[model samples]
Structure formats: C-alpha cells, structure tokens
Target: MSTAAAPAPPGDPALLTGAGARALFRAGLDTDTVGWAAASAQANLIAVPRADAYDLLLFAQRNPQACPLLDVTDAGSPATALAAGADLRTDLPAYRIWRDGEVVEEVADATPYWRSDMVAFLIGCSLTFETALLEAGVPVRHLEEGVIDPMYVTDRPTRGAGALSGPLVVSMRPVPAHQVAEAVRITDRYPDVHGAPVHVGDPAGLGIADLGRPDFGDAVTVGGDVPVFWACGVTTQAVVAASRLELAITHVPGRMFITDVPHTAYRR
Candidate 1:
C-alpha cells in the first residue's frame, strides 16, 4: 500500500463502483467519500469490544433513525457482509481510534489498533442517499462546492441502552426552497439510510446556534436554500465519547466504507 496521500481517482466519482473506491483507499487515498461511488451504498463503521457490542446494538435498535444497522461482523473478524473480499481495517479512507471517550488518533489503516475481540458494526450512512437526491434534481451543496458535508450535535437526547447514550447527531444539506418537498420525498424512500430530514428550516430548533460552525466535517454556505437535517451515523462517535468506552474504532467523519450493495436495495 502507498504511504503517500493520493487524490481521488481521476474520473466521475458518481460512476465508480464500491470495490473500485475501496481499492483507492486501500492504496492510500485519504479523503471524504461524499460523491464517490454515488450509485453504491456507503456505511459508517463502529467496531467495539465484544463485551460492549450488545449495548451498542441495543442503542442502534432503540434509535434506528440515527443508527440504522446494515451489517454486524462476528467477533474478531475484519470482513463484512456488505462488501465481499474487503478488509475493514484498510478499505475506508480513514479511521479514528478512541480511548476513554477521547479521539487519540486518526490513521489511514486501523490494523495496528484492531483487537481480537472487536465486533464491527456497519451502520447505514446518509451519503448513501445522495445519489437519489441528485437524480431527483435536488442539489447537494457540499458536493457542488467540493467540500465535506457538515454534521452537528443536537440538544435532543437519544434513547439509552445499557451503557450507551448520547445526543442526536445530524448532517445538514441546503436544499432549494422550491425543491425541499422533492428532496424529502426522494430521501424518505431510503429509510435504512436516514430516510428523511429530522429537522428543517431554523437550525435553532435543533439547538444549533451557528450554521458556520459544525461539530464535525466542513460547514458550507446555505444561501437561499433551506437547511435540512438528517439523522447522522456519526452519533456513534458521540456515544463512544459520552459512554467513555475503553476503546472504540470508527470511520473518520465524512469518510465511509463503500459497500457493494446498490443504493436502491435500501429504498422503501
């Protein structure tokens, strides 16, 4: 694998296959995957010790909108049902290593930090629905601006399960005022990947004081469009931090594990 940082593969990212995207990351392309493999499904990864797996699973079940689960690997395994022949440790653009509620390090490959008892959870990501939004003529501002999508932590609390609990996290997109309904209509079809906007219009309703400052990812200009919020899988990181787990592994914010599953597979 190349140690040098590489740019996105030269081509239309929307036409890239899931396996093709993984190959790029495995070879050392460390960038957010917002528009890459637009036709395929993408996932947020959160791998925890087997002892804590049950609690995390319960948390997802209790809060499906924020933590829709696509696949959960058996303990100690690096493979997932979502992508055949893919190595979880190195296939994502980046990984975060957490220790006692704090992000200790971010790395291109997670193999050095992986534990034998780890149980990897593949949670559905909102990025999986972007293709649908674009196909319906709804603009994805971050993609248009060539920046990462912005994510925020809301004041709303998630349902607790065992030792796992945290505030709801959301990803925001600026939708044309006239196309807000169409955007909602398109996204609502993919319930497995954060179906629809949890909150729209005023960011203050979600307790977000400023649109320019975001907790994770880059903030984008909203312009005349309405700000729409969707439940974010990054809520797992918030839970990892809030619960103060001894150790946890997750995909970097905005960087996801591309899956062979097509976006249509999750459409309602």
Candidate 2:
C-alpha cells in the first residue's frame, strides 16, 4: 500500500507578479498536482465550446459575486486578454474535465481536450485579496500551512440563469477576532472579487456542520479565530455539476490562472 505524497509548499505570494507566476506555472513548477498556487495571485478559468460558452457567460453575469468574469478567450483559443503570452492549456496546476456534469478526469494539460470551438473564461477569485490581507498584517492561514483554503457550499441560493443555478459556495479563512473589521474593510474595496464576507463567526448558520471538514480544499485550524466566508468561484463548479453538461473544463479548485493584472488593480 502506498500513501499519497504531501503537496510541496505553495510559492510565496509576495514574490511573484501575475505574469511572472503564469510564466512559472507554464514552465512546470507545481504544474502537475492539485494544489494551491498563490493566495493573492489566483484567478479561475473554465472552458466550454462556442455553442455552450454563452450559457456560462450568462451564468457568470447572473451571479457576479460567485462567478465574476475577468476575461473571455476567443473561440478555440488558449490566450486571454488578461494575460498576454499565457497558455490556458497548461498554466493551471490541475484541470478537471467534465462530462454530463460529472468529472470524468483530472489532468495537468488541457491541450488534449482542446476543441476547435472551445472558449475559455477567466473568473475573479477571492485569492485576489490575498496580498492585501498579508500586507495589512492579517495572516493568510492557507499560505502559512502550505495548503488550499477551506471552501463550503452554503445554504444560500444564487439567482438562476438559464439552466445554471446552485447554492452559493464560499472560501473560508480564520481571522483574529480584533482584525476582522480591518479584513472586511480591505476586501470590501474589491467588489469584483467576491467583495466582503457573506457570513462570519458561526459555521452552523451557513449550514456548515464541521469546521474541520470542508466541501473543497484542505481545512485549516480555526483555533481562537473566527471563520470568515467569501463568495467563491467554485460556485460555478456546483452549477456545472447540477446542469450535467456534456463537456466542460475547469481549473482544479485553488489551482488558479494567474493573470497579468497586478493585485493592486483591485484596490480602491
């Protein structure tokens, strides 16, 4: 019997710019594993065919908090307006290929699944706020622990768009009680990236039964701190699961597409 390998420590978020991280990911850093890349420097990507891409776009528009769109690639293309010279096929550390809404395979390269009519959409993720949190002296637990943050699908319902609608999904971080106000104010400035906390404190209120277990990502030690929840791009995956689409491609949770945009761009 073999035990699974522990993921290597995710890179320092403060060290890499968006384009720098994309270049590194494209060159094969932690590009083969399902892991978190960077906190403040991550964005989500999803690819679907031209015939079905519009549905995702409309779905994103309907629930901007959960699926904020940053860039939409041209049909059959891998490059994005958000990150020049970036290849969507291999930049993310992991990719999930879905069929009929179920993940049929998880891969590192999406080139094999590439189709002539496929279009990729880049969405804003809460990791976009990572740098600011660190800069303000607020700890980023996932980065410190060398793992992905916890994510939960809440009891909350997102407004429907066509056939895509599901419960709101959230990424969580444990924040010290005193600085919670500062964290809220700092993240509130970027409404495009999930904005502020949707809920704070009690997990049961959001229908989360255990803080140690999460729907996605690795759970962190909440300890003496209160748990803070933010709307997450993973909500789109829930929609995809619910819709049962014939085919879809998405960056594995937390393995995001680092863009060319500076993290500071989101600051007010």
Provide the clashing-pair count of each candidate structure.
Answer: 0, 0
Residues 1-268, candidate 1: write the lDDT tens digits: 7456575575777789999999999988887898988889999999999999999999999999999999999999999989999999999999999999999999999999999999999999999888888888889999989998999999999999999998999999999899999988899999999898999899999999999999999999999999999999999999899889989999999899999999999999
The TM-score leader among the candidates is 1
The candidate that wins on lDDT is 1
Model 2, global lDDT: 0.81
How much does candidate 2 score in TM-score? 0.90
Q: Report lDDT per candidate.
A: 0.93, 0.81
For model 2, state the Cα shift of residue 166 in Å: 1.5
Residue pairs in candidate 1 whose N, alpha carbon or C atoms collide under 3 angstroms: none
- lDDT of each residue in 46-125, candidate 2, tens digit only: 89888888788888888888887888989999988777778899877679999999999988678999898999988888
